[model samples]
Target chain A: MPDLGISVLFKGKNLPRLLGGLWAALRISLISVVISFPLGILLGALMTLKNPFVKAAMRIYLEFIRIMPQMVLLFLFYFGTTRAFGWDLTGETASVIVFVLWGTAEMSDLVRGCLISFPAHQYETSEALGLGKAQLYRYIIIPQAVRRLIPLSVNLVTRMIKTTSLILMIGVVEILKVAQQIIEANRTASPNAAFGVYLAVFFLYFIACWPISMLAQYLERKWG
Target chain B: MDHVTKRFGNHTVLDDISLTVHRGEVIVVIGPSGCGKSTLLRCINALEKIQGGEIKLGNEKIEYGSKRLPSLRQKIGMVFQNYELFPHLTVLGNIQLAPVKVQKRNLAEVQAEAIGWLDRVGLEGRENSYPRELSGGQKQRVAIVRALCMHPEILLFDEVTAALDPEMVREVLDVMLALAAQGRTMLIVTHEMRFARAAADRILFLDGGKIMEDSDPETFFTHPQTERARRFLSTFQFDNIKKL
Candidate 1:
């Protein structure tokens, strides 16, 4: 029933700040994904091997990271690393570092699962066709794996984008932080300003993520 | 091969198998399910490594842990029981893949050759279809031509028709016969005794990982040397008698 913050949003420099916050969120996500994907895929491929030492070492790292809470990881990198490692770490740097680690661990498992998910017969058949290990993966195994990998990895990437909202807790001034600031700034001017600001943040996230989620679903149906 | 051996941990899947496959000959291997029939065929291309002894394919004498396997494998093509067509490739894509990728042949030439093979096997119209879109017999036929496209010296068929419908088995065996009629060297592990009799120059009866009997299909089918061979072929004999 009250006037929404559209007038306020369009009237001054507020909208640019909101756009900047979205840019921050996207930048953190893109950087983390770009760095993590290849490392994760390599780690995942290594995990598929039968070597005892490699398996044990990677399993320990994967389990340690997997069970630890993401927020705990954030805090550990932001606060604990400063104390324990004697390092100067900013909120944005820590967020990027923590997200990169988390994304690598998560994406590696997805790659490993999809890599090994093909029927064992495919491997033997490829070998019988005189395909080397590299050629086998490039020609036969990887193409099918890409079908399975894309849907699941896209979901993980989108989840990482949403989880970037947690970076605001460490004070990165992402979209959620920007919304909070707008709500506080208009607390008296528009008593219902919190609702409008939060709603905008919700729509911003949906706009960013809905297409990827739909892509995952479409890929699953087509590939399965 | 002289004394080719394959072991899985302590269990010897192939206990010192020794046999020779002549060029342009169809040697059909027949035995009970766990008698290492498939394993012996797999060892020819070194798909399953031999723990001991040697395999001579063409001029290469393959030993344990030979480095020449990948190149040597180009001389040997295999068709699996499950018809492992590259599920991601279209029928023509599956057929042309090895010729283009492994053989380093021109893609257009390989594609045209693949189309010809597909037509020969009555799969011409299905070139653009995926593996999942084909029937079991059609898939097996495509699998065979995919191997044939590489122009290998020998073709190893590991129960290639085992996973088909009763009606579909004959369709695949007919294609195998066509390959055999062309004087192609073939080592087939199969239970289809009729096809074995119809197409094989020699029949190798394997049992307990040993070549129990290696004789002409006419001799082995009519007068098996070992009791195991007799028992194995008696079922085929019974089926023939039932037809009578």
Candidate 2:
């Protein structure tokens, strides 16, 4: 067999370091998802306001976030804002901030879609039943909306996990960054190691996101 | 109740409609589809904005311009044809929602009241069932009790039995008739002539957004005043009305 790069990966004690990087990426994604879920719900609800000024402001924010790519968002938060505002932010902290911003917008859009998809008669019924605003939301609106939200939210979590790889671009040393460094260091001696290393990275991502995908499918089947 | 007029962009839905419902009166509003019977009931609860009129519920003036409509709405309970129960909540939860959230009643008090209403409607055993799980008649009954838990001064039923199967219609109507016997003020929009004759104190026939005939149920059904009332009453062949 051609000199397998597997031995190379293990020989230099690089495996554990790669594992650590994977863990770091997972951690950042988890924190961002947790923060963004509720923030997304709040923003999504605010987007439905009847006030013209509030609606206009939320529309502008949603449109801006949708137009800008997440990479640009990361760079803006990590480098641009740090330099402009003169606030010291670690790479991990900045990655979380960027991911949350992106995730929140995405999740908010999902919530808005879910809320508006409900039959209009639901609101009329609540009004006829003498339900006040708080009662309407707590008893009627949110429960129905949440049923549709769960599957979409699981899909978002998977997206957040995969997108966490972008954090390595800003020097967070996540799994992909570690893989690159390993491949580069072994390039001259074993020129063919890049493909195998990328394959490993792909498997790692699949392992991380596969269960989330299953969860989304399960919720859709169960709730739909 | 006073003169109430409602317009939807230039289309008039209710025009110079004036009627008074005494305490414990059951007034049944019968009209063709799109004749604004539902709109008139919505106006009493201030759900629909009336362009040129006011509704006085007791001493309080309910107007389209007033912001205290929610407070007024609290005093009036409404039931829809579709039995608009909150799908997320259990029957008990539906009944207790307004009491706990809007009225700020204690949780135990709300639960007890909800249980009482459910029992009254013969839904005591199905308190935990969701709207999707209940039959249409049961859902409408729950909707009724949900409104009654708030102790509204007047109850509005907008074709409440119209959506039910023929067999299930009597169950809901029975509960409503029982409520009427308790002297609850009611304004019902219905196509059921028999229900009007059996339960209503007065019957108002609406046509083209105007009150074509308004009188006691006996006279309104037997001696319809205008040609419009006569034509409208003639369309329904009630088994009880023999050549009248």
Candidate 3:
């Protein structure tokens, strides 16, 4: 076997850049998740409105998001929009915007599923209790719906993190992108670096997502 | 209310059903299952849409189409058979939710009132317990208090004891009797004939989605006007009657 570049694992000089790349990836997912959650909830609630026109509009938007792939959506935002509008946009900013849009659509669908899955008698009880719309949501509807949403939202967070890898395609230089650059630069000197670097990348993703996966499992066990 | 007709497709669930409930009266609706008794109760609070009818609560017509339905619902409290308490909230939080959010009462005042209601229902100490933590009877009691905290002018019960264990039924019935004794106007859908006799001022026997008989509990139970009411009474077990 060829000499492996295993020493790269202990190179202190590369530590800061790796950590910085990891932080950037996390920040992109974190801010997008925060912005998406509330926006998704509001839009999901609006989708249930009695008005036919509004409901139709919401349905169209939801279907469009569901049918299209996220990679295409990211490309549309990062490349298509820039080309169409002649705008100057950085890769990180474009990635954040695209991820938030994608996350919002997925989260809203999760919220909608939660809201509609509640037993019909729940709304009847709310009506019977003399609860107004605000009270119905604050008390009966939201409380019950949120319990169901929690596990699903945690699952969505993991998806969002994994999908952040797609940002590397748009030149955001996230962890996978950094790993790719390092491996390519060292391929001539140490061809074995490819396997070790990719393996490290795999561990990085597992480390980032494992806790959220566990959280989803914990919530399901506790609530379901 | 006058000339209320509710239909589902070709079937009429409540056909021109008309009745007047005076202030401070207790009307117990007893019927075979699927006789529209629940639907009628639901109509009073606009939980079910009335295809063609008018419901007047305190001189104001209840409008199913109006955006003001929420406000109108606030005056009518409903207790469900399933005791649909918010599973995520504590017993006290369930009661205080509507009071604080809809009524916009002060949090302290709502909490005090919730505690008072819980005490009345014999659940004063279980305020912090979630619905899942409570027994079926306790959950129903909390549901009742949650409705009562809205301070509605009328209370509607849809088979409140139907879902309880036989042994747990009395605790909930006692709470209802206490509320009735306090002169709360109530409309109840129940299979408990004894409760109808002891607590209800009038009994309305429903069949095929229409009121088959309506009279004082003594007269209605002793001398049912319709054959359907008699058939229904025949199925009631002797042991159930003794318990009542």
Number of the top-ranking candidate, with TM-score as the measure: 1
Residue A203 alpha-carbon offset, candidate 1, angstroms: 0.6
Q: Candidate 3 on A38-76: residue-level lDDT in tens?
A: 999988877777889988887887788778887898788
Best by DockQ: 1
Candidate 1 yields a Cα-based lDDT of 0.86
* Model 2 Cα lDDT, one tens digit per residue, A49-126: 788897888788788888998889888888998779997788899999888888888998899888888787788767
Relative to the real complex, the DockQ score for model 3 comes to: 0.54
Q: Residue by residue across B106-149, what tens digits does model 1's lDDT show?
A: 99999888889899998878999999999999999999989999
The full ranking of all candidates by TM-score, starting with the best, is: 1, 2, 3
lDDT of 2 by residue, B1-244 (tens): 6678999999999998888889999989998899999999988877788888677977889875366766678888988889987777788877887778777889998888788778878887899987889999999998898888888889999999999999899999999889888889999999888988999988889988999988899998888899888877788866667674
Full-model lDDT for every candidate: 0.86, 0.85, 0.84
The fraction of correct interface contacts reproduced by each prediction comes to 0.79, 0.51, 0.79
Task: Rank candidates, DockQ, best first.
Answer: 1, 3, 2
Decide which is better by DockQ, 1 or 3: 1
Question: Candidate 1: deviation at residue B116, Å?
Answer: 1.5
True contacts kept of 3: 0.79
Q: By summed lDDT, which 10 consecutive residues of candidate 1 chain A come out lowest? A: A4-13
Between candidates 1 and 2, the DockQ winner: 1
